[model samples]
Target: MPVLEIETIRGVQLMTMNRPKSLNSLNEELSSALIRAFHMASEDDEVRVVVLNGAGKGFCSGLDLTTVDSIGEQSSRFQALDEYGWVGRLALAISECDKPVIAAMNGIAAGAGLSLALAADMRYMAASARVTTGYIRRALSPDAGMSYFLPRLVGPNRAAKWLFTGQDIAAFEAEQAGLVDEVYADGEFMPHVLRIAYDIADQAPLALTYTKRLLHASFDTDLRSQLRQEFTSIKACFATEDVAEGMQAFSEKRKPIYRGR
Candidate 1:
């Protein structure tokens, strides 16, 4: 069986980590499979939204220590964290994906698993789901973009509190802290999240992509620069057929069917 299971529902692409016996842990094979999956999803015009989840009880338990790089050689160790490595590529593939990506946490996520979720555009958690920065427990610091994305998601103070003490954050607490977009009962979680993904899919694809791009760029740019980007983006949108369809739909008081053009 594949390490990652791929499925499609409407315009939403579901990528489920399948190492269930180990709680969907990220070994080299699983990590590489995820990188390829995200890239394929991004290139497929049919995929408007992506939902990442895990099989069985736990979402992902981070690295499979038995299959990772050894710590013996300091100079070349932790190659998974290098720019071209599997873990790094997977995180970038999610964050920089043209379409919006949502992390569907069906259960617990720790270490690099939580980092992957934090890299996504949005995250939806089951009531029973939990997440933690587990590196500290292993006598290590954050990896796989955890250090970068966490502070941006929850602010420096909150990020510090969690990172400093490797505590498992419950769904309720995560929602309250803005670490997750929404939380729902475990049994109905996927259905609820799918509805949201479909609603977003209903919008013009180009508009959604541009919106995500602008949002990501906003963090490192000035107000003037962001305004310029917005101006350029809207101008570009005006040239697309979807914008015309949207306008016509508004006039007719009906939903628009965008064709991505």
Candidate 2:
């Protein structure tokens, strides 16, 4: 069976990490499958948005430790680095994808799983879900872009505290800490997430992609450079057919039908 299950509803691609027996832990197969899935969504013009979640009681429990233990000490260190590098690529792909990615945290997300969630453009977590920087608990340091995404989302100090302690963060606290966008009741989580995804899909695709790029660039760019990018991007958006349709729709008092032009 495929380690990852993919389905599309409307223009939103839903990618589920499938490994319930292991709490959706990352092994080599699952990691590679996930990376490919995101890349596929990014390349597919029909896909306007991506939603990532897991199947089972937990979102993900982190790396499959069994895989690590099989390596000898001399080779384990190098193997570990290579494994994390692959995982990092997956996280980076999600961040850099053209389509906005939303993380639906249905349950516990820890270690690298937390890193994956943080990489998304937005996160909608279930009220019963929890998150943690689980590396410290296992005497491991952060990897899979956790060190990169966590600090950007929650600030350095709070990230430091969490990484240092490896403490479990409840869904409500995560939302308040800016680690999650919103916390929904468990029963309403998927519906709420899909609703937001559909809303985003309703906008001009080119505009949304440009906006996502600009937001990500803001972290590394100065105000002047950012303004220049915004000017260029907005001008490009104006040239798109969707913009014309949008303007016409407003004047006609009807909803715009974007063809992703």
Candidate 3:
């Protein structure tokens, strides 16, 4: 069976990590498949927004430890680097994708799986779902961009506590810490997430893309540089047909029909 499943509803592309037997653990196949899926969504104009979730009981259980033995057998250092690089690429693809990526966490997300959830622009978690930084428990450090993303999301102090303890963070506490945007009852999670995704998809696509880019860049760029970028992006947006449609709709007292031009 396929390790990942892709589905589209309206303009939102939903990518499901499909390894229920293992709680969607990241193996070589699933990692590569996710990289491809995110890249495809980045380039696909039809995809206005992307929602990532997992099948079965958990969102993702982190790395498949069984594969670690074989990975260590690589004769050359470069081979080892290349193999490990795929995990970074998967995280990068999600963060850099033009369309806003939302993580809909259905259950437990631990170790690198938590990193994956943090990579998304927004996260909506199920009430029963939980997340943990499990590296310390295994006598390992964090990977899959966990150190970078976690600190930024929850601040250095909270991140340190979580990383050092490897404690499970329930959905309510996660929301309070600002790690997740919203928490819904398990039964209502998908429906609410889809509704939000569709709402975002209905907006001007170019505007959404530029806004996403600006938000991500804000962390690294100075205020002056970010303002310049925002100025340039908005000027470009004005040239698109969607802007005219939006103005027209306002005048007509009707919803704008954006073509994403």
Best-performing candidate as measured by lDDT: 3
- Per-model C-alpha lDDT, please? 0.91, 0.90, 0.93
lDDT score for residue 13 of model 1? 91
lDDT string, candidate 1, 1-261, tens digits: 999999887798989999999999998788888888888887899999999999999899998888655432245556644554567777898899999999999999999999999999999999999999999999988888999999988899999999999998999999999999999998899999999999988889999999999999999999999999999999999999999999999999999999899
Worst 10 residues of 1 by lDDT: 68-77
Write one digit per residue (lDDT tens) for candidate 2, span 17-46: 999999899987898899888888888988
Clashing pairs in 3: none
Lowest summed lDDT across 10 adjacent residues in model 2 is found at 69-78
Q: Count the backbone clashes (under 3 Å) in each candidate.
A: 0, 0, 0
C-alpha positional error of residue 84 in candidate 2 after TM-score superposition, expressed in Å: 6.2
The superposed Cα distance between candidate 3 and the true structure at residue 81, in angstroms, equals 5.5
